[model samples]
Every structure is written in structure tokens, then in C-alpha cells.
Target: MLRADGIHRVAVEDPGSLGARQHLRHCGLDTPPVPVDTDGVRVDELRATGAPAVLLTPAHQFPTGVVLGGERRRELMRWARAGGLIIEDDYDAEHRYDRPPVPALRSMLPEHVCYAGSVSKLLAPALRVGWMLAPPAYRDALVAAKRFTDLGNAALPQLVLAHLMESGELERHLRQVRRRHRRRRDAMIRAIRAHLPGAVAHGAAAGLHLTVTFDGDFADAGLARAALAQGVKTQPLSWHSQRPGRPGLVLGYAASTPTDIAEGIALIGEALRRLGP
Candidate 1:
């Protein structure tokens, strides 16, 4: 889309989607960081960048977990209609545990939104199976790009995924995983409350990960290092942020059992104490 629109610059949420940032840089495009709040990416801030296009993870924002508010969605549509473009990465929209499902922005404004999804999160990442829905104007270009990238993804995995989708097995599997993930999410929240006082968890209502922010003077990168030294892995929120803010960590609980989640968080708490406020 950036190539087709003659746009060399793009805006992405600060402490936002890492995949989007990586891809933008890989293409040699300038990705100015925009701020995200309780309502998702700040469209007003995006406008300030004057970038012709913005990449967004609206349903459940990466790291932060904020959904795009209704008003902001309309504002984005207006922005797109006025010649700006939106690259919507519909990442992890299927794993909602609380509240009704939020509709994808593409549903309302297909012409301006380039939507992408994959079974990597659903089933496994090794499959490398996914699909894209692009507007007519950019469809051919995207396809050509995909073809040149790796001559397209493997076919057997795609066929297997198709069979799973056709047999309703995928939906059934999702239902099972949702239950497990919800339990894990609940476990992480409990662990946070018990072990890490003063830490606030964000985007708990959906997605495979939870972002916890702390109001303190501790350096998140140092804290992450300490946690890693204790054999507890974590991604410092600072690693994802282009701008400065409070210290935090982005933790994923999908693969961890509740007991492991509690142990890992407790180790993080210990690390925090060792590092001081």
C-alpha cells in the first residue's frame, strides 16, 4: 500500500505493534511513532505526523491491549476517505474472553483498509499460513510482492488448514483454547495482584498477552534483565516504545500453565524488589 500510494512515511502506535514496525523498516519506510491511550492509537497524534498512511492493531492493540473506540474508528475512516490509508493488522481478534466481539474496521470501510490475518496464532506459527484482503487498487501489487518474497507459503499446510476450517474443527479448537487462555489470563491477573502490588495490567479482556505498567523510577530494561537472570523471560515495555513513559513489561501467558504463570510473576516481583523503585 505504501508503494502504491507513493507514501514513503507511515505512523505506528508508540509501544505498539512490533511486527508492523519491523515490516515498515524492512521496506525502508519511515515509521514515525504515534502515542496510544485508553482508546487505542491516537488519531490526533497520527494526523500531527502528516504521514499518508498508518498501521494499526485496533481490535486488541499489541502490548497495550486498548481497542479502538467507536468515535476514533469513525475519525480514522474520515482520515482514510480524505486520501490517507490504513493498514489493519487484525491480530488475535478471535480470543475474546470478556465483552462482545468488536467488529473489524475493515467491515465498515473495506476500500481504505488492508486487512491481514493468520493461523499462526490460531494453530501454530511454524505453519506460516495466512491470507490478506486488500482493496482492488493494491491487490495485484500485494500479490506480486508476496510472490517475490518467498514464492508464496507452502501449499500442504494451507490445504490442511482449509480442511480444518471446512470440517468446523478449527472453530472447535478455538473454543477449547479460549477456555484455557481465559483461565491463564485470570491466573496472571491474580498473580499480578498478589505478587506485584502497584502494577496495573492492561488489555486483560482479550488477546494472548497482557501488558503491565508500573508507576515508579525503576528502569524497565534493567528489571527485565534481572528477571531474565532469575530464569523468568519478559519483554520490557520500553523495548516496544519509541517515546518515553512509565516502566512496564509485556508478558504472554498463552503457553504457560497457571502454576508457571504464578511462579514467573513472583520471580518478576522478586526482581523488582532487588532492583528497587
Candidate 2:
């Protein structure tokens, strides 16, 4: 859709999800970094980039988990209203532990927003079924693209997912996972405090993972490499940013057992110690 409109540059939040940037790159689009702050993506910085479209995970900002502030959302709406396009990715919005997920930006202005979500976050990843609500202007183009690409997803899975949704089974599943994920999130928090003394955790109110930043000018990539060498996986905060920032790790706890989460953080602590002050 963007190609049809001659939009080659897509603005992504700086310190955003690396996977999202890679995906955009695969689409042959240039994703320039737009600064993101505690209030979410900086609209002023994004506007300065002159990018016609943006992809966002605004309901719960990835990595930071901050919702787009009211002022920014309104500003974004104005931006989109003036011939801009928005792709809202509400991935893992349902897993929020602190409160009900905020209303999606797409709901406020469907004409300018392309809202995308998936069952992979709610159900199993193997299900692989997701959805996109595109604006009417691009619906036909998108459908044709899907038809030519993999002939669209498997019909059987789509039917099964539809049944699950209509039967309220999906909601039941989300409820179950919410409780389990909450427990795991709490466990990870406790572990971060116990195992990583100088590390400050952020964005724990929602999402399956949170970021922990160490004090001082520590190098997180080295810490991440050390952890990986010890058979533990972690994402360095710098990997997502086009600019340098604090040293931190993006850690996910939802899939691991509480014991394993604790052990992993302990290993990370050990790795950091091995790196020295």
C-alpha cells in the first residue's frame, strides 16, 4: 500500500523493536529512527522526518510499555488526517496486568489507521493466524497482495480461529494466560530486585517482558554476549536504537518457569560481574 503511494520511508520509534525494523527492511522500506520517550514516540521528531506512514505499537509500547499520551495521540490523529497513514500494532495488548488495555488508536480513526493484531500472542505461535484492519482505500490492494502471497493463510486455521472467537474460547484463553503471565511477571520482578542489585526495571505494568537498566556507563551488549555464551538469551537495549542510550536488557519471563527466570537473571548478574565495573 505504501509502495503504491510512493512512500519509501517509514518512521519507527528509536529504541523500538528490532524485529519490526528488520521486517520493514525486508519489505524494502527504509525505517528511520524517530525518537521515543516515556510518553511514547515523539510526534515532533516523527513530523520532522517527513515520513508519510508510521508503524506503531501504541496500546502498550514495546520495550517501554508506555501508552501514547493523550496529547500525542491527538497530534498523531491530526497528522494522519492530513494524508498520512498509520499502522497500529497492538501486539500483546491483552496481556496487560495492571489494567484493561487502552482503546486502540484504530478505533478512533479507522480511515487513517491500519490496525494489525494476532492470535500468536494470545494463543500459541503455531496457530500463526493474525488480522489487519486496513483503511477502505487500501483494502482491495491489500487483499490482492495477500492473494498473490501464499494465497492467503490456511483456511482451516482461519475457520478454527473464527469458531474460537465466536465461542468465546479466545477470551477464556486470554483470561487463563493473563493470570499465569501475571504470576511470572511478578516472579521476574522479584528476581530482578534480588539478583540484579543496581539494575532498575521499567515497564512492568504490562507486557510479557520488561527492561532492566544498570547504573553507570555499563556496556550492555557485552553483558548480553556473556549471558548468551552461558546458554541464556537476552536482547541488549542498544540493539534497537540507532543512537546510544543506557545499558539495559530486554528480558521475557512469560514462557519460563519462575525458577528458570530467577536462575537466568542470576546468570546475567554473574555475567555482569565478570565484566567488572
Candidate 3:
């Protein structure tokens, strides 16, 4: 919709989401940094941007598992109420292990939030089937964007997804993945505890991945590159941050078995160890 409306400026979380910002920039949009706290995107900073729209993953914040606290929810509401657009990315809302499912912000402020969800993490990224619920104002334009982009997704996959949704199979599969993902989450947490004592883990209460930060002086990007060279791929926390911050890594456990998870964490431990005395 940014393309259709010619809206060039967007507000994103600082020390958050560099890939997203780069994607926007690739499309000729300027993404300004907004600070996010334990609550969520700092509304005051977001408001200060004066941008017309913002993107967020409110249910389970990206790179950090913290849920948007209630007070900040109201803050986000006020920001949207005051003519701000919210792009809600409900990416990993279902995999939550330590908490109840948080309701989508769009549910409360439909006209102001563009809620998006996909079966990628639930099933597999190959599914590539995602749904977006947008405000009425931008609905038509977004539909036009979808139509021109890929002709409304593949009809067969959409039909299959619809069948699963209607048959209760999708929900059942989710329950299964939820259990498996939780076990993997626990394993990763233990692996971190047993392996990387100095690293702080975040976003482990939910999602297929965990964020681990270290207090040491090594660059996260360098560590990630080293890990990659060692045959272990990880996303550097710095890769997501727009502002300077502590070094860290984002590790996915869903696709790997517990044995692999331990090995991966151990490998990361070895990599970090190689960086120091």
C-alpha cells in the first residue's frame, strides 16, 4: 500500500528489524527508528516520528519474546487513534509456550491495524500461505497489490488451507506443533543454561526461535559469520538492530531435533569461546 499511496516514511523499532528497514528502503521508503521496551514499540517515540504508518509484531515481539504489556497496548491504540496506521505481523502467535495467546491488536482497533498471519512457522515456510486482515480504507488497495503481485496466491493452496481450517485439521496440527515446539524451546533453554552461561536468552516463552545476547566484546555479526563458517547458520542480533546495542544471535530450534539443538548451541558456545580468552 505504501507504493499505491506514495507514503515514503515508516517508523520501526530501534535495535530492531534491520532486514525490514532494508526491505522498505529497497522499495524507496525511509524507515525511522523507534525505541521498543518491555512493553513494545515505545509509543511516545513512535508518535514523535510523525510517520503515517508503522510495522510491528505485537503478539510476540520479534528478536525479543516480550509481549506488549497492556498499558502500551493502549498507547498504541492512542497512536493509531490519532491517525497512525499499524501493520501488525502476527507471525508466531501460536507457538507460545509460557503464556496464553495474546489477541491481535487489530481485533481491538480494526480500522487502525493491518493484521497479517501465516502458516509458515506452524507448518513450514514452504506453505507460504499467509492472510492479511486490513482496515477497510486500505483493503481494496491491498487486494489490488495482491492481485498484481501474484494473482491472489495459488488457488489450490488457498483451497487446501481453507479445507484444513474448516475440517479442524489445521487446529489439530497446530496443537501438535505447539507441543513439539514447546519441547524444543525447553531443550534450547536448557542447552543455553548448560552451554552458554554468560548469554542471556530472550523470546523463548514462544516462537520457533530464541534470542541470546552476550555481554562480551565480540561483534555479533562476526560471531554469526564464524558460526556460518563452522557449518552452523544463525542470524546476528546486530543484523536486526538499527541502533547500536549488545551482541547476540537468533537461533531457530523448530526445524532441528533436540540432539541438533544441543549440538547447535554447543557449536555457538565454541564459536563464542573462540572469540575470547
Best by lDDT: 1
Q: After superposition, how far is residue 121 of candidate 3 from its true place, in Å?
A: 1.1
Per-candidate TM-scores read 0.97, 0.96, 0.95
Clashing residue pairs in candidate 3 are 65-203
Please give the distance, in angstroms, between residue 32's alpha carbon in candidate 3 and its true position after superposition.
0.7
What lDDT score goes with residue 107 in model 3? 89
RMSD to truth, every model: 1.1, 1.4, 1.5
lDDT of 3 by residue, 1-277 (tens): 6767767898887656667788889988888888877777899898888888998988888877778889999989988998888988897898888778988999899998988898888766786898889889887888888889888677777788889999999999998988888888888999999989988998878888999989866688888988898888899998888888888999988888888898888888898888872
Worst 10 residues of 2 by lDDT: 119-128
Error of 3 at 197 (Å): 1.4
lDDT tens readout by residue for model 2, 78-171: 9999988999999878888887678899999999999999988777789879889999988899998988888878888889998998999989
lDDT of 1 by residue, 158-221 (tens): 8999999999999999999999999999999999999999999999999999999999766899
Question: Which has the better TM-score: candidate 1, or candidate 3?
Answer: 1
State the local distance difference test value for candidate 1.
0.90
lDDT of each: 0.90, 0.88, 0.85
lDDT of 2: 0.88
